[model samples]
Target: MAFPRNGLTSAAPADTRLKLKIARKWTSAEGIVAIDLTASDGAPLPAFTAGSHIDLFLPGGFTRQYSLRNDPRERHRYAIGVLREPGGRGGSAYVHDRLNVGDLIDTSRPRNAFELDETAPFSLLLAGGIGVTPILAMAYRLSSLGRDFEFHYCARSADRLAFRDEIEASAFAGKVRFHLDDGPEVQRLSLDRLLAYRPAGAHLYACGPSGFLDAVVSRAKPGWPADAVHREYFANAAPKAQSDQPFRITLASTGRSFDVASGRSIVEVLADNGIDIPVSCEQGICGTCVTRVVSGEPDHRDLVLTDRQRADHMTLCCSRALSAELILDL
Candidate 1:
């Protein structure tokens, strides 16, 4: 999927939707199902990098993002491993219980926020639970390129590890390590030891549950440079704040103003005023509704934006204004 490189906000067109058929589906591990999607016409699908993900549009107006786990070198199909979240908002449950092989579904083009730094001297890839999807793709690319990399996978138990068989059979199996929570203390992952030695020109990437990711990042902060540590979250760490103050937003393009009430989002206010902003995950985890800020400070609540991105842009889905009013480049 091609997007503007200038980091400016623009509405997504309806025609960008792609239809794909489930070519194959099987269980990858306990509570995990691997699904292979191919173009409905049997034509080549768009090429995606290691950490790219496609937004799957499900029934009941649900849109969920899933990381692509297939090897980047392959173009026939895009593979994704989904963990059934019975407690989640219907998306995962629908995917596990309702979706099936040969079913046609709509998805957005692959977008990558967790890109691998191929020029690095060494790479440290970390995964926790079902967060292994993107890391598995990165490992495959690194192995194929013969890059110096180490993949550390952590799970609660041996049976809960997804893609265990694939990792064991991979050509770079020797560079991979597994840590199980039920295993001995010595066999567990030592974050202290892992972050102590900083390999020159090495970059670290991690994806997993919020607590697991926080542990890796907190440990790496004292030793690793800010630019060298990359991470992707499957969900937001903190819940929405209940003390959001009402604010006014002015659209730069049309000079239109809207009043955002407490307990309501900027996007909702815009939509109520006949303005439409393309959005996927309303929880602010995905970067779909990111809009540029022309003036006023924004109280950014999205997990998708980095510190740099927060200076000039804000995700309209959940973010509010820190000032009395905000001017946006809508």
Candidate 2:
């Protein structure tokens, strides 16, 4: 490797963990509402790409991830939509019923698990319900580049559709289509026809509920290349493992080993042994506790890791070991 003659110049990400306040809030749909967040200190916020999400540090010590819906080119404000999930674990309820405009909030810098492939010749963006948040951002970027792209939004009804006004007034308004289940029979999103078309070097992105994303992924699997398809999930309801057994966690650096009981979790056992790994969303939805596997097989139970990525890493917070002894890159 050769160093640059200019003595290595690079830009570090600006601090986004600043004191943030909700500058504005409005109802976007029947159950969804949008909020605009700005730094209270009046400093520029961190730059974010399309499909990025930020962690909201809310009351009751709850942290949740919400996608950025506003234009990525702007640094002054970030917009996100929240769907009140009555069955949720209290995060959405807080945003809908308690959290308010002008209230100071803590937010992490944007992180993207579903990234847009900018070099693609054409793109297809699909959003189901509130999943339109990140997809809308991509639409903004695509329209700015003068690129060829199509945006499809699927919802049970027009009332369930968020950001309809913004979409109608956008530069790519002609490229947008709305699929409502309650509308005409011909208007509902037909996966049979939608997944049948494949443009050369075209990419597809989907986000929404788990069932919605699963439908899109399964339908496009046969036609779209695996690398060309991207999807993101807001929450995961992974089933409990029925075949869990006792296993060993061996730290690679210290050669320390800990016995993990079948009834307990890896994170609990690790913390008892004086080793703490960052943990968030212990339900295996968040990728915060993912750890590298040096040796042994993992009975991967996380929602974030792909089949290829499961070969070397596992989420320590919820995942368990398949082998009797597993070595971790601690």
Candidate 3:
């Protein structure tokens, strides 16, 4: 029920699940649905920054996260764009099929893992597909600050690009460039073209599909400074992790215990046992799965917690206990 210290909030306890009523739904291109929403009760909600995402608890026990695409300063409502991924595990299907205007849905409060660094001299943004959601916010902020920046957005085509007009109308539009897969190869962004502008003080941020991210990362390695490159993958990274090893989790509050099999995560195990713990992006970026360690060390595999946070609290969703037994603040 408590909010995250890093300015993230969840639905109120009594309202553990807030109803998201669609105020408007429009297709950005051919298939992508840009959903704008307001709480059904029409009450004020917690504010969020760019790169913040919310957990939508859908039917069939599915929880999918979508980044906030609208200006973060607007506290009255939330907006997100969902691409109908037929290959996806039904998350996008429900968004495009069952959801509609006036439909009430359960959703989590805003939580952010991808955030912009205000101190950076300039920003170079790369967006692919729906990955543009968070970068869109950074563009807004950087524009307001009058920071020098450039946005290279690549999508299959113009129709698939979300908020094309708005992004162009933004104060940062002069620096914005669009690349369509259907266009000639020279028009698309390549390491060769982007690296030319990678000045000494510029910071590069990229987000998109794994293939696109990999391409960007490979291209950036040559000339970009180590600290200047930052990337966010909307999907989980490759699981180089070994097979699961069963472990024991001891809860300090009630002295309860549970067994976390190698096949499942601690968060999933706890949730199955009716334990109430807040979590989003169960893959690890959201930091919603953070819990204090009572005893023993953690394996610390999640991306949410920093080196300092891992020395203090650990993220239980993707991280596991490294020691024989571990105690946590359940």
Top-TM-score structure, candidate number:
1
Judged by lDDT relative to the true structure, which candidate is superior, 2 or 3? 2
Question: Can you write out model 1's per-residue Cα lDDT over 163-216, one digit (the tens) per residue?
Answer: 999999999899999998894532689999999988999999999988998899
lDDT of each: 0.84, 0.81, 0.75
lDDT (Cα, tens digit) per residue for candidate 2, span 1-330: 000011111111125355689999889999888999998987789899998877777667666778898889999998999888877678887888887888998877877666888878899999999889999999999888888999999999888889999899988999999998895533699987999979999999988888988889899988898778888776665576646899999999999899999878888898787776766556565466788999998988777776777889898877898789999999
**Which candidate has the top score in lDDT?**
1
Lowest lDDT block of 10, candidate 3: 1-10
Clash count in backbone of candidate 1: 0
Which lDDT tens digits does candidate 3 get at residues 1-330? 011121122222436667778889888766778888898888887788877788777777667788887777787788888877766677888889889898888887777777777678888999998888888888887877778888999888777788898898887788999988784543566667777657758888887887887788778888886557776776656463544667799999899999888767787788788876766566666666788998987877765554666776887767887777789977
Estimate candidate 2's alpha-carbon lDDT, on a 0 to 1 scale.
0.81
Model 3 RMSD in angstroms? 5.0
Better of 1 and 3 by lDDT: 1
**Which residue pairs in candidate 3 collide?**
29-159
